[model samples]
Target: MPYSRLKNLWGGTKSLGKLKVIILSHSQQLVEVDELSEACGLEKIDLQGCSSLKSIPHTDQLKNLQLLNLSGCTRIKRTEVEKKIKGLDQEGGLKETKSESMMFSTLAVKLEPGDNTETY
Candidate 1:
């Protein structure tokens, strides 16, 4: 199922499974997934074009999470993202991917008005 639309399932109140990877591209505010990190033991997540995604979800519960791609989320401040990535990396309980240096990698790309840029 699409992670972005998970909230819509069963009227915005359903716990999800432990997702290995979640892609939220061109989505609106992803605040809906705030509880997902805790409920599902979420790991890798990609917020490529979600311009409305301004803040990073609290990820202390996502212990085993490794990779996160926030390339084109223009509303998200660079410093804030940097802090979140640094914190996640410091958690030090998961095996990270080779392509993902540290915890997050922001690929260079152009952001649309309501859409974030592209990422792998």
Candidate 2:
């Protein structure tokens, strides 16, 4: 089911029971980001380059959630992601990983496109 465009499954979904990954890489119009809360078993998610998306709801409740991709989401911010994936670290920041150590110590990675050369 990864990379499948289940546009209607957001609010309609009830459970995913240990589903490890999901991909929504490029979409034309996915405005509501809050409906993802229903999938509590999700571990990784890809919402990269979703232009119409404006915000991501708080996802601290989804404890299994780990990797997140916001590489080209121009409107999203680091603070917004920090606030969403709260409670992962002591100071409430993205966890540091061996491959990519984000600004936070929680299990999160905020991507911003800039001439600075960054991550997702």
Candidate 3:
């Protein structure tokens, strides 16, 4: 859902055992997904433009997650994203291919025109 009014995603999500993708792009007020960790089978979570988001559930418990698109999330630091990816890499949770690494690198370093803030 884009441009949604949600501030958080909590109750009732734990029962989505077969859920694979969640597209909450541009939900500007969204700050958290409290039950995200319970969605073990999720593969993609696209929170692309959620500018007010502060944090997400830790990636360590997301064994089946393949993509987490946090692009344009101005409240999240690039360093934090880098650290999470690094930890996932160390634990073999993400593919170690050059192209995949490059993609994350690009996402982490990308900056908006005239925007020098260090956030992704």
**Candidates sorted by TM-score, best first:** 3, 2, 1
**Residue clash pairs of candidate 2:** 93-106, 94-104, 94-105, 94-106, 95-105, 95-106, 95-107
Flag regions of model 1 displaced more than 4 Å. Answer: 1-12, 28-32, 82-120
The TM-scores of all predictions, comma-separated, are 0.53, 0.59, 0.65
- Candidate lDDT (C-alpha), each: 0.48, 0.54, 0.60
Best-fitting candidate, scored by lDDT: 3
The TM-score between candidate 1 and the true structure equals 0.53
Instruction: Kindly give the stretch of ten consecutive residues in candidate 1 with the minimal lDDT sum.
Output: 109-118
lDDT of 1 by residue, 72-95 (tens): 555565445444442433221222
lDDT of 1 at 15: 59
lDDT of 2 by residue, 1-120 (tens): 334454433545556666667777666366546766656776667776565556775665555765666655555555565566544332334443353323332323532212123223
Q: Model 2: number of clashes?
A: 7
lDDT of predicted model 1: 0.48
Best-matching candidate per TM-score: 3
Task: Please tell me which model should have the higher lDDT, number 2 or number 3.
Answer: 3
TM-score of 3: 0.65
